[model samples]
Every structure is written in structure tokens, then in C-alpha cells.
Target chain A: MRSRADVVVIGGGIVGLSTAYHLAKLGADVVVLEKGYVGSGSTFRCASGIRAQFTDEANVKLMKYSVKRWKELSDELGYDVGFVQTGYLFLATTEDEADVFRRTVKLHRRLGLGTRIIDMDEAREIVPILNTEPFILGQWNPEDGKASPFKSTFAFLMRAREMGVEVHEYTPVTAILVENGEVMGVKAGDRTIKADAVLNATNAWAPLVNEMAGLDRELIPIKPFKHQLVKTEPIKPGLVNPLVSPPSWNDSYIIQDAEDGGVIGGAGVEHGPTYDVTPTYDFLREVVRWMTRIAPPLKYVHIIRQWAGFYAKTPDSNPVMGEIKYVNGLYIAAGFSGHGFMMAPGVSEAMADLIMKGRTKVPLDWEWYDPHRFERGELRTSAFQIG
Target chain B: MQMRAPKGVMVLGQTDGEDPRENIIICRCNEVTQKDVEDLIDRGITDIEEIKRLLRIGMGPCQGRTCIPLVMGIIARKTGRRMEDIKVPATRVPIRPVPAGVLVGELDEE
Candidate 1:
């Protein structure tokens, strides 16, 4: 509604706000159009588990870059992002799984991460409440942490605003104005906010937005899977401070918040891809079944709350970043799966660099995530999981 | 009969029956206290939806059935927003628990 801007980032979640913040910092006029309140999307509903224990090189590099940024984010943004490095522990049961994890540990060490494969005894030492009967090996990175999702999103929004970015909540982008296969502007509500470039950070709803540009059929389906998480009542403090990834991922991960001491966890995320965020009774049941064996203490723990979120899953579980080659000035920043929350710092910097300087100096190779990679039959796999 | 109560010792016992405040639980499921809602409002959470997401006021397994009105009342009173203006987030399906048995047969999801 401000007539026009240098760029229009469609989506006010953390990704869009981070993009706007970087773009505005680089002296570009940015207008963020949020269909709902900022962070009201999957940003606020995520389990807020920030980890760097990845099997893929690209993901590991991105998260390794992110962990450093998160450490310095509060100072940079002038707001406490509530980053707590409680560590992320993965439980491996089978011998084959443990062997794979041992190799992963070497890869992690080479990447400058402190991820080491510890025996079951060390796992119990790390988390006193952990039930070690189900597992033999554990993978842990002492530095992998989580932050306040709402706080970080709000901080990014504030910094972006301070940099002169105009954020319009309740402003849904209706269409993207294109001409001659070149980028143009975006239509939001009744007004046309003309711009030379546009970034699609609409996550789960990217498919609908892609349709406006007449590029729907060409892209791989980024389905929206409904994932749910539950929070337990404040439990007595124990050594179980680190976030524990259940053996086999078992559709669950448990972590006690540093502040509230509330054990936040979830499982049974095999829920089908739908816009429906309805938390099912199945999740509560699964939580009980898994919690009973994973952590004996949580068997009868009261589930104080439960909420659902969307995992914007791509064909390979890897995000499709960088620019859409065929569409000039049109950048793709969504499809980060569940890791989008933690990887925002790196992704935003790369996207901003690509938009401003025509390239990113970040260690990541953007070509691997090209939107047209599927067309060339080059599907990349990522080791991250969602519950 | 000998006096059993210690003179200066703090009595550690259930006080719900003695103190009216202890029994007054806004959201019985989430155990949200009235003070909790007010404290959130003090922190500048004017919108109902924002409060819902942050405090998990209406996010229990009962799906806000018991807490929505109570939370809305607190928000409406504090923010001066009319009840109609402070909309409750729509409750989605599977309001009741869906047995895993239902989801097991259809493993091949496209």
C-alpha cells in the first residue's frame, strides 16, 4: 500500500522477516506482506529444537554456520534470542545405526562440530532421566541448542523495521505481476506493490503462491505435513536438560525448556499432508507409548498443551533455495522443511547476498538446491527429520 | 491431650481447601492461573491469538473447550477489546483422538 518498494517478500514468518532484515540492512526498501500476524505460521508452532547434527554435507555446513550466528544473534539484533545450547542427543539402537553414527561423528569433527558418539553410560550421564534399555549408542553435540522461537522472530521483525522495512500484517499477496517472463510486482489485497524483485518465503503455502506466477506444474510438490508437539507440566529439575532425539527418531524428541523446566516433546508425525493443523488424539497416545520407554519418569507426566505445525516437505527433504533460473528477479527461499527455524540465519544471508551482489560467499553451493534440479533428475537427500 | 502442632514450624500440606486462590484454576487442564493471563497482558500481549500461541492457553488436548471463554474474558477485560473482536482460533478436526489403528492401514500416502 506504500505505492512501491525495491522488493516484496511474501511471507512474514521468520524466513521472510530475516530476508527483509538483511535486504533492508543492505539499503534496499523491503515490504513484508504477512497474510496473518508475524510468526503466526509454523514459526511460532515449531518445537524450537535447533541442532547441527546432520548427515548431509550441505545441511551440516548450513547449521554449523547457523550455530555461530545464533550465539551472536542477541548482540546483533539488540534482543535476547533466548538461545540455550542444551545440546541435541540422538539415540541409536542397532549396531548398523551405531556404525553409521560413528562415521557421522568423524564427519562432524572434521566440520568443526563437537558431535561425538557416546556409549549408553555417557548417554545416561548426559540425561539422568533417560531410559537406556532401548539404545546402545548416542550422538550428541554439546553446542547444538534451541532458542525462543517467538522472541527470535519478533527480534528479526523489530530489526527489519528499524532498518526501514514496512511490514504489513494481515496483508495477503493475491498475485505476482509478471511480464515477458521477467519479474515485476506483487498484488496484495486491492493495491499493486510494484517491485523489480520478489522472494517467495510462504513455506507450506508456496504451491498456491507459485500458481500466481504460472509456474505450478513444473515444480516438485512441497506438501504440507501436519506435525504436532506436546508440552508437559513443570517437572522437578534433573540432569535431563539436553534435548534428546528418541532412538530411531520414533516420531519424537524430548527437551526441557531452560527457563520453565517444562518437558516439550512430540511424536506420531506420520500425519498426512494437509492444511489441517488439528492436533490428533493419536499424538497424545504415541507420546505416552514412547515416553514410557524412552524416559520412565514421563510415563504419567501431564501433557499441559499440544499444538500442530506444518512441515513444508520437498521431494528430498532438502530445501529449494537460490533463484528460479527461468524467472529473473524471482528468488526461492522457502521449502526448508522443519529445519527452517534454525537455518534462517544462513539462508537469509545467502538469499540477501544473491539478491544484492548476484552471488553468495557463504560456503554453501546454491546450485545443489536449484528448483530445476528435479527436472535434471538430481534429487538431493537430507538427514534431518521432523516429528 | 498434648499439643502436636509446632509453634514456629511452617506447615507443609495441601492448602487448596484453606486458600480460595489455590482452588481457582482458569484452565484446569493447562493449570493456567488468573495471574498468568494478567502477567502476559502486562507483557503487551493484546491479541488473543498471540496469547494463545505463547501461553498455550487454549492448546490442551481438550482443544480449548474449557479455557477459550475464560482466556477471552481475561483478554477482553485487560485490552478493552470486545469479545467479538478478540476472535477464538478455530478448532480443527480430530477434536477427539483418532486411534492409530485408523492411520495404520493407509501407509502409502502420496
Candidate 2:
């Protein structure tokens, strides 16, 4: 690796590689450091669903912008990221939950998103096999979609390398070298690479990296939570085009990949915060129970694999972006909770703008994702978090 | 009745097939040819999981039972790495393919 660089970004997932690509496009020298191979972290384990049907206005706007970028990403990178606009469906089983959907639909419509509250008939039209007995209403957004996380992450990495960005795999940063309250660089093994700026893009490991920089955990409280998912053997393609979310069934979500015909699904289980990524038998049983309840045909399918990953959760379930005020030349783009894969495109563009020009051009409410929100007591309502 | 060859095995004295080596199928379920596996290896993707995700090599009903060892051998030959150095894909639950109906307590009607 080079002994010096203009900027060093930590992490090699979608966020880190996309940020490196954007930074290089803006004429900034960039270097990306990863503890493992690219996309081996949370990016590979993500469900890969993208949507703009969020309750929060800022989140909706950000996702809408991200969807636009995702549509054009394949052409821009000259590699197919497997982005398909198969739509996202959210089901509500009670009147209270339906009321929340109504409010969210209003907010989504106001933000220029093509989301609407659909009746049972319209919901059945979208997904014919859906069990209508469980849900009273549904939220549908046709613009929302899914992409292949491996393709997307590698697309960014390959393009970033072509644009003069240096990426080093298996190079773990041992310590953040801070001198006289200013960011110097990082020490990896026996070598020290001095950089003008350092960005902490390591999602689940952000808190640990921040502590290495001598920042208090209370300043940026990021906790890791383990979530598991399962993939069934290939059924028939296009069986389930849209991502199906049944909020009453432990927040279960299901989607079928068009390329492989495999039905991928998962559900949230109550567990304490930890970094352990061991998949549990209890999770498989719970998720399968809810999945088979929604669609009986899935009961005949065979599960092929199950794995777990971490979500770098914040207090309000939004990301923490922008520069750190306590330390000069130190920036961070982390705490995405579980939505990092969907939000990577827009977040990278906005982060690049913030780093080079001290502001973002995207029309997002930046204050909602301020890194110091917990300290300022200005935490907004958590976005409608689901699989 | 004539006995047909297995899904991925090549029959001897078959001269009608064109480019016999490249046409050889490695993943019978996914129809992934030797060319497909070699092209990805040529592009510097040696990781078994990445290859599986990109090409759907081991995602079929057999769950890598028929193709993983063959693909690992090809990777070892192309990258000049020892077979032991190549990491194997992680094995998951339901070692034998168990239908989801069995997990949810659904039995066949008598």
C-alpha cells in the first residue's frame, strides 16, 4: 500500500466502495482499506430491497433519489447490478396499522413518490398467492425494487479502481493516528499512511473504530444487532415479484429473485444487542412459520441456506453522516441500521459533496441524520423500519 | 430402451458434440458450463461464495452437492492455488433437503 494518500476510507462494503468511486470522480485521490475481501461484511448478507415508502420525510426523499440512481447504475458502470423494479408491498393487519399506512401514503405522495394505499382486491392483483385473511390493507410502491448486493458492490469497486482509487484488501487499520487534536492518518501493522482526511465507513464496527480515534462512545452511540435470513431452493421465476412485508407476523418480509428463482425471506426476532453473527435454529423456525402462513405454497419449498449479519443501529434508526466536530479532518458515514444497502447510492453522492464542498446538493433534510443528534436531543421519529 | 448418460457426465466416443471441453457442464441444475466457470475465474473471482452468488452455481435443489467439488478443482487449476487453501462454502441447516411442509407440521393425507 502507498505510504500516503489524500483520503482514506475504512470498509470495503457498498458504502465504502461507492463513496470511493464518487470521491475519485470528483478529482480526489482515494484509498479504501478493508479487513476482508470486498462485500464480505453486511453488504453480502443484506436482503437487497430498495424502497421509498418510509414514514419520515427525509428518508423518503433520500430513498426516492437513490432509486433514480439505481436505475441508471448498470449503464453508468457498464456492468449489470441486477436492479429490477419489481415493487414493494407492505401489509397491515389492524385498523391502527392501516392508519399508519394512510399517513405514510400521504407523506410519500407529498414527496413525489408513487405510493398508495391499496384495497384487498388491488393487493391480490399485485401478489395473487398472498393470503388475504391476515391483512386488512396494503401499501404499494411500484418504483421500489431489489438489486444484487454482490454485483452492486463489485461494480463500484471495479469502477473506482479504474478511476485511480487504490483499494487494499486484508489490511486492517490497527489505530487512528491523531496528533494535537487533528487527524493525521491510520496505522496498519508496522506502516503508517498519512492522509488529509479519514472517513469511518465501517458500519457495525464503527463504534470500535471511533474509540480508536479517542472519541467517547456516548458521542456516537452505535450498537450492533444480529439479524438472520434464509434462502429456499429455486422455485419458479416471477412467483413473487414484489417484496412482501407482513407487519403483524414479526415483521416478516419475502421476495423472489428473478435470476435464480430462489425465494429469500426473513423475520425480526427480539434479541439483545451484540456482534455475534451465528444463525439460530429458533430464527429459522420463527421465520418459516410466518412465511408459510403468508403463502401456503412456500411450505412445499426447501430451504437451502441460512446466515446472519449485523445492523449498526442508532437511537432513531437513521444513519450518522458528516464530519466529526471534536476532531479535525475526521469524517464518518455509518450507523445505517439495516437500510445501508438501499441507501448507499444517495448517501455516497451526498457524502462526496459534503467532503469536497462542505455541503450536499441533494434535497434531503440533513439535520435529521446529523451525527450529533443524540447530543442535541433532536432525534426525529424513527423511519418505518422493516426487513 | 437405451441407457442415457448422467446429467453432467460426458459419454465416450461422442464426436458429434462441438468443442467438447467447453461444452462440458459443471453445474447440471444451473446449466453452468466449464466455460462459464473458467471465464469467472479468469476475471479474478476466486471466492467460492462470490462465484455462487454471481453465477448461481450451488443454489439449486442439490445445494452444491454435485458441482462444488468440481468447481473447486477448476479454481485450483486456474489460480495455481492448492486445493486445501481454497475455502469451502459454509454448510447450513437441513443437511438433507427437507420440505418446508415438514418443518410446519404438515403431513401427507392417508
Candidate 3:
């Protein structure tokens, strides 16, 4: 590992690697430190769904840009990331939920996203086995879809390595070296690697790193929430083409991978902050119940595997980015809640621009995701946080 | 002993001079060939889980029972890792396949 670099990113998940790759592309000396093997964290466990049908304008814009990047990612990275634009179908059971979908679709279309509200018949046409009895309508975005998380993460890692970004695996950052409220470097094991800037891209574990940087809990307030998912044995392909989510069904989602023919689905369960990633019977039952309700044919399907991971949740369900106000050169890009994988492409580029040029040319509502928002008591309304 | 083929019948082990290894199916449920596994391994995807996610190697009805060890051997051979050191994929719940209907109970009960 190098003893010094222009910037040191403190994580090696998709976000960190993509950011490192982008930073290296910008001609910055970058080093990525991973506590475990690359993508062994939440990236490996993620559902890998990418979408832009968000209620918030900023989120819509950001994800639309991200989807655009995902479309071209395979060519850009010189590796197929398995990106498929099968679309994302958001089901609505109640009038209130339908109203939210209506408004979100309007906002999405206004931002040049071709998301539209579809009737029950159209929804059934998209997913032939969809249980339309539970959902009155669905919001469909054909531009949004799913990708291979492992492929994308490895793509970025390989490209970053090719671009001379040094990556050290199984090297945990023990401390963020702060002197007089200015970032110096990080302490990993017995060595100290001096750096001009340090970024806390350790999503679920961002709080621990932030605290190490002397940021108070009140100032950042990022918490980890455990989310569980299950994969069913491969059946015939095209059973469920799009990523389907019903907001009323515990925020459940079911999508079948076209390449693999395995049906992957999950649901949210109310839980406090935790680091536990053990798969639970309760989560399995809940996901099966909700998924079977969404698509009754899934009841006959057999679950092959189950796992859990963390969503680095902030109060407003938005990420905290940008440099720490009182601490110079200490930047953070964590607290993505559950949408980091999809937002990675755009986030990495914007974050790279921020780190190198001190501001991002990529248009996004920067103030809403400002690292000082918690301190200033300026939390924006939560983004659409469906599974 | 040499087996003689009938006038219209082909021998069991004969493939008309094709590569016999191409007929070796590592994952029968998915029809994944030995070459498929080696091709991915050649691409630097040595991890079993990453290979599974990308190629759908052991994601079929048998749930990796027949192919996991075979793929592990291939990876161990290709990556120079010992058989014991190659990480296995996680075995998930129900152990055996349980129908989701059984878990959710009767439809009328809801």
C-alpha cells in the first residue's frame, strides 16, 4: 500500500470504487482502502435494481442521470455490467398511494423521465401473473431497470486499478487522522498513509468513521437499518420482467432476472439501528407473504437463498455528501439509505468533481444533501423510499 | 473391448470427432458446461458467489448440490487456491425446497 496519495477513500464498495475510478480519470492520485474484499459489503447483498421514478425532483434528476450512465457503463468500463432496462413497476393499492404515484409520475415526466401511470390491465400485461386484485394501478418507468451489482462493482474496480488507483483489500482504516480540524490521512493497522483529502464512503458503517473524524452524532446522524432479501430457484424466464414494488405491501418488490431466470424479491420490516445481517425467519415469512400477494404464482416458487444487508439511512432518506464544514479535507458520501447502487454512477462523477474542482458541474440539489444539513436543521422531505 | 455401432446407430461415447469435454455438463439444471465455468474463471471471477450472480451457475432447482464442488475444483485449479480455502456459497433456509404456498398457508385463510 502507498504511504501517501492525493486522496484516500475509506471504503471499497460500489460507491467508493466508482468514485475512485472517477477521481483517477480526473488525474487525481487515489487510494481505496477496504476492510474486506471488494463488494463483500452491501454491494454484494443489494437487489441491484436501478430506477428513476422518484418523488423528489433532485432524486429523479440524479437517478435519471444515473440510468443514463448505467446504459453506457458497459462500454465505458470495457466490461459488461449486465445492465437491462426491463423497467420498474410501482404498484399502488390505496388512493393515497395512487395520488403519490400520480404526482411522482408527473414530476418524473417533467424531468424528461418517461415514467407513466398505468392501469391494472397494462400492469398485468407487463407482468402477466401480477395479482391486480391488491393493486389499483402502477407507475411504470421503462427507462429504469436492473443491473448486476457484482459485475458493476468489479468493472469499476478493474477500471480504477487500470487507471492507477491503488486499492488495498482487507485493510481496515482504524482512525481518521485529524489535526487542528483539518484532514491529514488515515491509520490502517500499523501504518499511517498521509493524504490531502479523506472521504468516508463507508455507507452502513459511516457513523463509526464519522465519529473517528470528530463529527458528533447530532451533526451526521446516519443509522444502519437491516434489510433482507431472498432468491428463488430459477424457473422459466420472463415470468416477471420488470422490478415490481407495491408500496402498500410493506414496500415489497419482486423481479426476475432475465439472464438467470431466478426471481429475487424483498420487503421492509420496521427495525431500529443495527449491524446485524443475519437472515431471519420473520423476514422470510414477511417477504414471502408480500411477494406471494403481489404475484400469486410466486407461492409455488421455491426460495433458494436468503440474506440481509444494511441501508445507511439518514433522517430524510437522502445521502449526506460534500466536505465536512468545520473539518477541511474530510469529505463524506454515505447515508444513501437503500438507493446507493442505482445512484452510484452519477454520485461517483459528482463526488469526483466535488473533490477535484471543489464543486460539481453535474446539476443536482446539492443543498439538500449537504453534510451540514443536520447541523443547520434543514432536512428535506424524505425521498420515495420503496423497496 | 471395442463396441461396434449398428448401421443407423451411433456409439454412446462417440461424438463424431467433436471435443468430448464440450459435452460435460457441470450444472445439469442450468445446462452450464465445463467450458462456461472455465470461461468465467478465466475472466478473473474466481469468487463462487460472484460467478453465481453473473453466470447463474448453481441457481437452479438442485440449488448448487451437483455443481458447487465441481466449480470449486475448477476455481481452485485456475486460481491456484487449495480446495479447502475456496469459499463455498451460503446455504439458505428451509434447507430443502419449501413451496411458498406452504409458507403462506392456504389462500382462503387470508
- Number of the top DockQ candidate: 2
User: Cα-based RMSD of the predictions, in order?
Assistant: 7.1, 3.7, 3.6
Q: Relative to the unseen true structure, what is the C-alpha lDDT of residue B20 in candidate 2, on a scale of 0 to 100?
A: 54
Candidate 3 DockQ category? acceptable
Model 3 lDDT per residue over A88-188, tens place: 99988899989988987888878999989899999888898889987788889988899988788889988899899998888999988889989999999
User: Could you tell me which residue pairs clash in candidate 1?
Assistant: A281-B97
* Residue B34 lDDT, candidate 2, scale 0-100: 82
Per-model chain A TM: 0.96, 0.98, 0.97
Q: Write the per-residue lDDT of candidate 3 for residues B1-110, one digit (tens) a residue.
A: 23445555665765655554566788987788787888878866577877776666766778788999999998988889999997888765657777777777843212
Q: For candidate 2, what is the DockQ?
A: 0.54
Give lDDT tens digits, candidate 1, residues A170-262.
889998988988789999878999898999898888878888887874485678888887676667765567778765757577888665566
For all candidates listed, what's the TM-score of chain B alone?
Answer: 0.69, 0.75, 0.74
C-alpha lDDT (0 to 100) for residue A6 of candidate 3: 91
Q: For model 1, how big is the iRMS in angstroms? A: 7.2
Residue B77 in candidate 3, Cα distance off native in Å: 3.6
Docking class of 1: incorrect
The TM-score of candidate 2 is 0.93
Candidate 2 segments whose C-alpha is farther than 4 A from its true place: B1-21, B108-110
Q: Against the true structure, what is model 3's DockQ?
A: 0.48
